[model samples]
Target: MWVNCRRYAVQAHNIGCYKTQQRPWVRQLEATYDVIVKECGLFVDQKRPFLGATPDGLVGDDTLVEMKCPYAARDLTPLEGVRKKKKIL
Candidate 1:
């Protein structure tokens, strides 16, 4: 399983490291949409403290964004497989 794979762990960590490096470019792209993005922290549900989400960026009051900075073409392969599987089912 990916959760138990060392490569998965390293890739997950790399995404965090690269996210910071890619922020400037991401912000520039977002500006084209006229959306002012802001940093967000972990949001814990009041009734369910154990359930939380830390979105990449918040756009205005109603939108939450998640960003991905894939390092290689194969970085997106897993998602492609999921999409294909969903279509088959």
Candidate 2:
């Protein structure tokens, strides 16, 4: 048995794609909710110390924002991509 231990880097173009969409996504959500979205840092799970995540934005006290702006799904809305069976997740 062989395991591939290759490491891959995110391309600059891909990062640009996500950055391009992030602001609009955040703005729309903010306007809809009528609340300010704040930047956050790493949050570790209390039950599992090994588990942690850096969410894209935070809303209020309980809502954690997680944005997925896949470059391939750039043209389609998230719901439309889901309906079309695009691997946006």
Candidate 3:
């Protein structure tokens, strides 16, 4: 796989956007659902030390929140975006 500056820049921008939008979105979810979203750090598997996953939020004891803030579908609701662009993000 080839790494390009444009790709890196795009990824960085997307990450920045997501970070900027994340808190407000999480707050809305908490207010709407009355559930606390616990922030998480990188979680490593004990048995497989090399493998890990960092979830966006942890809801309750068992549910993990994985957020997708797609740059291409920023102006559309999730359902509409998914319907219109099935492969975006």
Best by TM-score: 3
Worst 10-residue stretch by lDDT in candidate 2?
Answer: 1-10
Candidate 2 per-residue C-alpha lDDT over 10-87 given as tens digits, one digit per residue, 9 for 90 to 100: 434256666676778788778867978898766777999667666778988998888776667878875788798984
* Native-structure RMSD, model 1: 9.1
Candidate 1 structure lDDT: 0.58
In model 1, where do residues sit more than 4 Å from their true spots?
Answer: 1-20, 71-89
What tens-digit string does per-residue lDDT give for candidate 1 at 1-76?
2233334334443656454645764576477678877877668779986666667678889998765554443334
**Model 2, position 82: C-alpha lDDT score:** 77
Using TM-score as the yardstick, the better of models 1 and 2 is 2
CA deviation > 4 Å runs, candidate 2: 1-14, 77-89
Q: Put down candidate 3 lDDT per residue, 20-84, tens digits, no spaces.
A: 87788778778867999999766778999767666778999998876766667767764686699
Q: How big is the positional error of residue 59 in model 2, measured in Å on the Cα after superposition?
A: 0.7
The best-first sequence of candidates by lDDT reads: 2, 3, 1
- lDDT for each of the candidates? 0.58, 0.69, 0.68
TM-score of each model, in listed order: 0.55, 0.60, 0.65
Q: How many residue pairs clash in each candidate?
A: 0, 0, 0
